[model samples]
Target: MNSSQLKPLLSIGNKLIGFILFVICAFAIYNKVLQNENLNQYGADLKIQLSKIHWGAWVLMGCLMVLNYTIEAIKWKSVIAETNQFNIFQALRAVLVGQAFSFFTPARSGDYVGRTLFLAPGTKLKGITQMAWASYAQLLMTICFGSLALFWNLPFLPWLKWVAPWGAAFAVGLFFYNQNFKGWLSKLNILQIGTGLKWKLIALAFSRYLVYLLQYNWAAAMLSIPVTGLDLSIAIMALLFFLSMIPAISLTDLVIRGQLFLLLMAPFYHNDILLIALTTLIWMVNFLIPSILGAILLLGFRLKR
Candidate 1:
């Protein structure tokens, strides 16, 4: 077939993929909210708590969510600056739509597909490698903080306690030596993200991670999760640590979220409806809401791949 005929077919196919993503996102969200019988029982009380959340905390969570993705957008823009630069609006749009793609895909791997396509046609492929560097920084931050949270706050086996400090040391050392890894990436003729830009990416990722914890803290305080201070931080770090390690489509991860939260918080809080409510709240605020917005954004947007 002629190139012109193929272009039309490709456009139709892209539109179909977008439509399918929206359907999956909608179904996933519906399942996340309605499928939980415990959540249904407490739905009214949760709504009441949401209504009663101090106005200041409410504003903070809203601002944090905005800041969360804004940091994400800027991190993306910074990572790709040397190769393909786009404005903040484009970056933000791409990040949100990437969330939509991540919702149903295993390990959120669809995120690469969703975000990279927004790059100009020539740079899209390389954008994958470049952007992955930025994603790794966030993973690194989770590990670094999780280790510290473990070492400083939580108690462990007499034999295993040393593992926490050692883990933290290793993660910190890895942070400083990240340049060597970057060197390998460049040696392979992968994009040279450069030294300064690498630090910028780490700083942005660290800030985003803190904002993430702050949002959870606010929600926990509002819900009375029965833990506070260092203990609260430990639970959060543990939850984030395991969640990051799990390999699953986020669209079907409501169970994982609940189990992880209960397992991590077992010491500080009893298994109860409120814990369920906290997990549900964070999931909605962090994942489902953004993915829903992303799905809406995808409706008229062109899929590059």
Candidate 2:
């Protein structure tokens, strides 16, 4: 089909998919708020607890969020180095713009588009594809380790067990499909399909994730929630991270994550609602802060000519 024909079809399909996701997210939010009887009292207590938050901890968390963005910018630059040279500031701006797009778009595919717009004219498409593939590799590695952690934790929830295998299979399939594992690369006539520095890209991505985990841990501490075991926290947080990868969930992403954390850590903390409330607060800081900053960055700066 022609480009014109394909564009409308793609647009319609995306809208349909986005509508479905919106409904699901809305339903999940309604269920969590109304049906989860335990949360009502917890919500009241959470409000009281939040009213007593220490400003010092809030400041520290803010600094960490800035650090997270900085590390992410570095990671993107590392991936881009394989294809072309771009200034760190420019790359960082691109990252922010991409993030802003992700925040608004259902599937967050706008992130790729925003990033691509930042590339030099001749190699834009290739650069975008390469960065995407490299990012995918890192996520795949995370899912692999995370899956193992899940199994080890032996989460009683059947939904938890189902995620690991499905995630692993999807990651594996993506790797082979993108790489054309069966020698399909030759058909494309491209010199390299990814950023040449695969290991560095992976390292940068892995380090970013580590920072994210640390950020969450610190956030939990800030809320004075007791962390009984690192192993379980890691597994649960990893699962939360995996879920965040699913696009178009809206704020359901944060709510579901908070709920899951509560479910998994229930054994450790007698006060499940308080912990979940704390988790929700931490998630807000992690997501909303960046989103607000990214929006500012998007509005204030003009792309360099």
Candidate 3:
């Protein structure tokens, strides 16, 4: 087709994709927020909690959320440095775009899709390949720290004693494997990259994880969940690990997350409503808010020629 003919088709295609994304995100919001009975009830309870909140607590959490995503953006910026360096703003936009799509996809596969959209046509595939390394770095952090939480539970559930060590070993092995795998990425003429990148990636991921872990614990406290210190830390870690390792589809993932939080928190706290409210609040602040912003960005999303 001539450029004139092809241009219209491309426009239509982009619009179709945008429309589809909007629909998927809307469905997710409806299912997870609007239609959720648990959240609906929690909404009423949250109003009461809101009155009692120190407002400053939210300001701090908001700041941490920014820090958390900024760290992630910098990590992405570093990973793509050899291929195409992005400024902090560009990198942050790519990460938020990924977050937007992640809301409607299993295991957030849309993260790669959204991220690669910012790459040059020639570099987009390699961008995705490198993203795999970036993601592995983050997952390794979760598995390594999360293993301790699992091991802590071994006294009550002896089976974890058998599983935790092996799981830790496998996660460690994968981290090293990802490092060696960079050589293969280099062979693809796509990775022109750095030295000691693996350690850098791991360190960055750890920092980001720590920020969010602290945020989770703080959120739980604000909601009056009644667990603290080491116990709270373990529950938060376990929740993060579970959410990270398991794959769930679209809006349904929110439901699964709610259930998981309840199970993890139930042993320590008797108030199911309070726990569920806390979980919903965390979800709203972290996932839902950024996603709404991303959807607004998606309306103008277009593929580069």
Candidate 4:
């Protein structure tokens, strides 16, 4: 077949792959929710909680979700600025596309693949490397906060104390690791942006992390799960840490996140169904929603590969 004939085949193959992955993820999530007998018990209470939620609160949560991704797009755009100038809309689309691919891959590796595809054809490798630097900043925030939470909950299991220091050390390493990459970074002009951008990157990451926690707390309240103050903060740390450190397919993250909610929140709260509902809702609002929107956006996406 001529190259022209191959282009259509390649495009069809790519779309099919994306669609199949989404279906698999949806099936995994659906099966998990269905199998959870605990979740079934909350059917009526879940409805009640939804009814009690102020329309304003729902609107506020939606706004927060928008803010979350907006910040992320800004971060990605800044990282790629040295390579190419991307408008806010392009950055937003790239971020969503990353989320869409992340649904199927382990450790969300597909995120880089999806994002890099939007770069100038030959610059994809540099684009991915820069974008990954941005991700490292976010991961560092997760590790630091998660370690602190682990320290707070460590007394519960004294034998596991070693993990906290290690996590903290890893966070610290992530912060300085950029120094070792200075030569390569200079080649890509990442270092040309100066230390000011370094600080901005860290600040953006932490701010995004806090937004995630705030959204989760809101979701918890909406589900009638009474979580507050330091306890809630610790749970936030634990969830982010656990999710950050683990290597799992995006679909399985829901199951893992749900179990963590049960384990971490069990002492403070007793409603199993509420815990499941809260986790699932947060997942749907934060992750699944982006992926769905990304899928829609992907219909018009041209795959350079």
**Poorest 10 consecutive residues by lDDT, candidate 3:** 186-195
lDDT of candidate model 4 versus the reference = 0.76
Identify the runs in model 1 with alpha carbons over 4 angstroms from their true place: 1-24, 31-57, 152-161, 164-187, 303-305
lDDT of each: 0.75, 0.63, 0.76, 0.76
Superposition TM-score, candidate 2 onto the true structure? 0.71
After superposing candidate 2, which stretches have Cα over 4 Å from the reference? 1-47, 157-196, 229-232, 241-245, 300-305
Model 4 error, position 168 (Å): 1.9
Q: Please give, for residues 80-126, the per-residue lDDT of candidate 3 as tens digits.
A: 98878799988988888888878777778988988898898899888
| lDDT per residue (tens digit) for residues 1-305 in model 4 | 99999988988987676566546545544554465444465567756656777888888889989999999999999888877789988999889878877766788897897787689877787787778778888988888887778777643566555677686786666556544345546565543334666678889999999898888878877766777767877887878887887897666787788878788887688887777778777777787788777766666655555
Query: Residue 95 in model 4: shift from native, Å?
Result: 0.4
**How does model 3 score by TM-score?**
0.85
Per-residue lDDT of 1-305 in model 1, one digit per residue for the tens? Answer: 99998998988888787677677767765665566654666778767766766778767777878899999999998888877778998898889888887877789888898898678878887899887888878988887777666654444344434565576567556545544444546665455556688788889999999887888887888776667756777778867765776887764476677776776677778846677777777777777788888878777666654
Better of 1 and 2 by TM-score: 1
**Per-prediction tally of clashes:** 0, 0, 0, 0
Best by TM-score: 3
Error of 4 at 17 (Å): 11
| TM-scores for candidates 1 onward, in order | 0.81, 0.71, 0.85, 0.81
